[model samples]
Target: MKLDRKNLLWEGSRMFLPEHRRALLQQRKNATKLAVPKIDEQQLETMTYILQEAIEYEQPVLATYVTTYEVTCFCGFVDKVNQMEKYIQLSNGSQTEKIPFYLLVDVTWP
Candidate 1:
């Protein structure tokens, strides 16, 4: 049986044996076990500062980011570690908005 990129179990779904079903369930369980480091308020503030600095210097801020909120009920785990970019923008009233990369949970400034 081949699972497609869309996660559709095709080719033999209509004739899946009991063991196959169990295996599929186990795979889902394992996928849900992925975990991410917790992000506190202080950390968020710190990240914002780092983002601001990067934007000011016109440099990319690489970080191991994670999701701060669950977008779906079955999304049990936080986001995976990935690189991100940050920048600053001018908002209304001439205020500077530090656009920190969304869903960034961790960071390591170079």
Candidate 2:
């Protein structure tokens, strides 16, 4: 059967492509929310101290944080730490990323 071009153009093919629309919607739903891990008080304090030391001495660190789909890892120098803002900035020579405290799972420093 030949598809109607007017319907395709107006409806953008999604109406005819239910499977594709379902898959796209599922992907969007999976990425829309993140399951951030729960960090206790002691762990939080330790991570804060490690970040403070790394930032003060200008040392690079490897940190792992939880994303929606996986655990993301980053290796860079801790440039700034703001307790008031509850975020830490990391620089990897080319770019900087501001990661919130709740997302950080592990921090490895030298």
Candidate 3:
């Protein structure tokens, strides 16, 4: 049995009232427009150093990073860094998060 994606989407949306649909769309738009702060070169270098040290020593670090969806404060061991990919991987024992370098707001060493 083939399910038409367009039809399925339409049918699923039919379950939502007009007000619910409007609110859901508004939330999506706002989530996509999160503010990202700008950092000067010195601050960037400091954060980079903290990350490098943590990665080198396998130590946990506290860092504040943001994204289009939300900002997160994480204390975790640095697992990997990919400068070309512009991202870093952090593992906090419970979960590992992939953070974009541009979204990093701050880093404080332990």
Candidate 4:
């Protein structure tokens, strides 16, 4: 009796190359990335005004900022502003975050 090897097509070992896996991951990450938005001069002035007001009145605010990959929303109080560095410190009870002036998208009181 002779066993046939031609019928064992599905019995071969499955292999995944590391380079192929990395390429797949890169594609997925690029798909989720967002483009940076343009902020007009009027909008920039508005955001600056809102942030300053929040700081002076000790009011809570909602700030929307964007990065290369995503947009983030932070609900917090304006703790401090660094004029030289052009960044604002936001405190949300537990931790503080330093958001740069250019990344600011919108500011509102809630």
Candidate 5:
């Protein structure tokens, strides 16, 4: 069977827009449904202090990497935490990468 280029292009483009719009709507809906835990100011301050201490002490922090619709993965030995962006900087041998805080599962003290 042979396909017409113009017809194929038109059909493909028609299919793409609805999928993209659905994905965008679903993402927005999911974001609206998220229920994040809220910590009081004092507790938040303490957690920040602890994180700073961990960074200064060179302790290994454990974190979990979460995806939109998957079982979370674990990341260990996080060397730096960026609270502002809710991400952590981790070291694997000589390499390092920044990952989201929601992905972190655990932390270990030095």
Candidate 6:
């Protein structure tokens, strides 16, 4: 192989080996991960109130929550609030999702 700058380093290398490919994909995925936003006391109280309203009035809400990798928004009604376990159950029509209170970012009437 010629000693050109572009070819010198990878003269006989398998640049896309499975192990290297997997590592590169993992790094890319991690780069896109989102950090959780901080919720102040007033904001927390507002979200709590919205959840309570949803429960009492049987109304739907738009809830935004976060995870390690992404922020998710769900539209549903509050089904249950388990304070001891620190999670709330949200139900759309056919399915229900359990979301931890700590992960909640925002709640709005919808």
Per-prediction TM-score to the true structure, in the order listed: 0.40, 0.69, 0.70, 0.80, 0.40, 0.83
Each model's lDDT: 0.49, 0.83, 0.85, 0.86, 0.59, 0.89
| Stretches of model 4 off by over 4 angstroms after superposition | 1-14
Q: Taking the tens digit of each residue's C-alpha lDDT, what string does model 1 give over 1-110?
A: 76466545464556878998999998887776644556888987886676566656655444554433332111111122224554323223333233334534554364
Tell me the deviation in Å of residue 69 in model 4: 2.0
Where does model 5 exceed 4 Å of error? 1-49, 71-73, 83-86, 102-110
What is the descending TM-score order? 6, 4, 3, 2, 1, 5
| Decoy 5 TM-score against native | 0.40
- Supply the global lDDT for candidate 4: 0.86
Better of 2 and 6 by TM-score: 6
lDDT of 4 by residue, 35-81 (tens): 66889989888887888789788998888989778899899999888
* Residue 75 CA displacement from its true place in model 4, Å: 0.7
Q: Best-fitting candidate, measured by lDDT?
A: 6
**In model 3, how large is the Cα lDDT of residue 94?**
97
Q: What is the lDDT of candidate 2?
A: 0.83
Model 5 lDDT-worst window of ten: 101-110
In model 3, the runs with Cα more than 4 Å from the true position are 1-17, 24-32
Per residue, candidate 5 scores C-alpha lDDT tens digits across 4-103 of 8877777755655778899999988787553334446675565456567766776655444445544343334557667689887778577676866554
The best candidate by TM-score is 6
Worst 10 residues of 2 by lDDT: 7-16
Misplaced by over 4 Å in model 6 are 1-15
For each of the candidates, give the backbone clash count. 0, 0, 0, 0, 8, 0
**Root-mean-square deviation per candidate:** 14.0, 6.6, 10.7, 3.4, 8.3, 3.5
Task: Estimate the TM-score for candidate 2.
Answer: 0.69
In candidate 2, what are the lDDT values of residues 9-60, reduced to their tens digit? 8775355578887999898988777688888888878877888888778889
Q: Write the per-residue lDDT of candidate 6 for residues 1-110, one digit (tens) a residue.
A: 65677866777785578998899999999999988788999999998888888888899999899988988999998888999999989999998989988899999997
